[model samples]
Target: MSTPLKTLFDLTGRTALVTGGSRGLGLTMAEALGEFGAKVILTARKQDELDAAVAHLAGLGIEAIAIAADMGKPDEPARVVEAIQAAGQSVDILVNNAGTSWGSKTEEMPLDGWNKLLAVNLTGPFLLAQAVGRAFMLPNCWGRIINIASVEGLLGHHPRMIGTIAYNASKGGLINFTRALAAEWGAQGICVNAIAPGYFPSKLTGYVLDKHGEELRGDTPRGQLGCDDDLKGATLLLASNAGAHITGQTVVVDGGASII
Candidate 1:
């Protein structure tokens, strides 16, 4: 008889692609996946950063590789997929963690800025999924797609200081896309889900945290910014066997902030 612990959450033979895997939230989720025994391929624009993150994962006894590609580019996703396929590896999991945000008054935001945000935050994931999903997932009859979204997708940002209309819209669209993909692919044994984080000390929030760390923490029910470990369980639960039956769900990792 197999133990619950043995069968649940086991990712021993899985392969993953984590875009924006060089730092912050991306790296955190990549590390968690590695810890659960998945071979992780990290991709980002900066080769130096990807190299560093690959080295760090190696130190943890995880087999990781760095692929330097700008997922934001229109053609780069196919190139990155080709690189992975050339290595004779099939993607079993994809963490669409590459994203960007620009903050400015909606009226002041340039059209280019809006388009850029959608390219990285929304289009990139869709293209990557379409490429990888068709090549590997649909053929093998199994896969996982985890998009890293944000709480701002669920609710509007503070009117007094909120400035990123494009970011908010992209995230909202991402959530809906996750649900739609999950619904369509469930029969094919592919699970598509999202994780909406809140107030993490990532590069995107460094400026805000630097300026108002104390004030922000005070407002949060948890009284502290989200830590790296905070993302591990949820991600693993969604990516591994533990979540085989769960699909198209957005698992919010915020510390009760949305509840309050």
Candidate 2:
């Protein structure tokens, strides 16, 4: 008999770790997973924001825990994982959503800025995945790894847009990292995938959107940028049995922004 649709989407008994879960896309994805019955562990650099996020999740009746850690720090990922483990929870799902960006004309970009952005956007995800898989997923032989990428990864930034070559390069690397890791670990029952979002007014991209909202909207076939709910469906699928057979893929949630 075929499994019921609801059964495929259920995430009960699962624990999800969402880096940068203090706000924006990360929090949105956390909400999706939690709404489906997963216990969520939200990690970010600021404790106050995390506490507020936890409270918000609690108000929605979703079980959540918050940990503050900077992904740019080399040792932070392991700390976050160990903290969760100490609480008797294993991360069944990991959303590598913590990232940073720097905007400068390519030649004018500072080396330090590029390095910092890459550390968080690319290296941080890899470290967190390694720690989580080694500690929890590999032992249990089941896990979901979702990397938050960007449409800019698949396509170069528009000439009119502020230059963010480091951000673009890091996200591109993440997309390929998802594919390679999925191929390597699929046999172990770990699913690796990515979601490349379009313009969304969040802490990270609010300034860009504010500066070019009309142009971006006009460019998209949907005539709008992404919204709070835009990333939820894709987040839930990749984090649940609903997408068990899916791996090594980048799902673009850009309202058709990259099609052109």
Candidate 3:
């Protein structure tokens, strides 16, 4: 028989490690996981931001802790995993939400900017997944990896809209990474997926919103961008038993923008 609805979604004993969880989409997903009963471990570069996020979760009665680490650093992923292990916990869910973007015309985009975007948006997630999977998930024979991709990955951005070629390329690579990793890990009980968010008003996209919010919203069939809670349901589904059979998929949380 199938598990009960509530039971399937219950994450009572699970633990989640969310990179970039101090703010924006990372915090949104972390909040969802914590509210649903997962003990959340958030990692970000700034200690103050991490502390604030932990306190916010605490106000909601969610058990959460924070570890300050720069995902772009080569050694930081291993360091984060080691710290978690030292805490006597293994991550059941890994959210690769730590990322950055660089905007410039394709012809004028600096090599350094491209490299930075790729390092944080693509390479960092790959390193974290490898370390966390080897240390915790693969050994335990169960895991969930959710990569935060962007709609720019799926569709090219118009020059008039925003020229972010490097960011788009990185996210596109991340989507395929999700598929490839899922294929390799599925039999071992690890499910990998990506969330392709359209345009959310967060610290990362505040400038874009301020500049072209109306035009972007008009482009969407729903006539709006994603809100703070837009990702909650999809995140819960993939992180819980409700998504056990789902893998190697990019769940787009855009307000029908991709479709229209």
TM-score to native of every candidate shown: 0.97, 0.99, 0.98
Model 1, span 1-260: residue lDDT tens: 76597567878999999999999989989999998899999999999999999999999988999889887789999988998999998899999999999989999999999999999999999999999998899999999999998988998887756488999999999999999999999999999999999889888987777877887677788888799899889889889888888899998887877887
The alpha-carbon lDDT assigned to residue 151 of candidate 2 equals: 91
Residue 258, candidate 1: how far off, in angstroms?
Answer: 1.0
The total number of steric clashes, by the backbone 3 Å criterion, in model 2 comes to: 0
Q: Write the per-residue lDDT of candidate 2 for residues 1-260, one digit (tens) a residue.
A: 99998999999999999999999989999999999999999999999999999999999999999989999999999998889879888899999999988889999999999999989999999999999999999999999999999998899888998899999999999999999999999999999999999899887887898899999999999999899999999999999999999999999999998888
Candidates sorted on TM-score, descending: 2, 3, 1
* Local lDDT at 215 for model 2: 95
Clashing residue pairs in candidate 1 (N, C-alpha, C atoms within 3 angstroms) = none
Q: Taking the tens digit of each residue's C-alpha lDDT, what string does model 3 give over 1-260? A: 96899999999999999999998889989999999899999999999999999999999999999999999988999999999999998899999999998878999999999989999999999999999999999999999999999889999787786689999999999999999999999999999999999999988898899999999999999999999999999999999999999999999989999897
RMSD of each: 1.2, 0.7, 0.8
Ranking by lDDT: 2, 3, 1
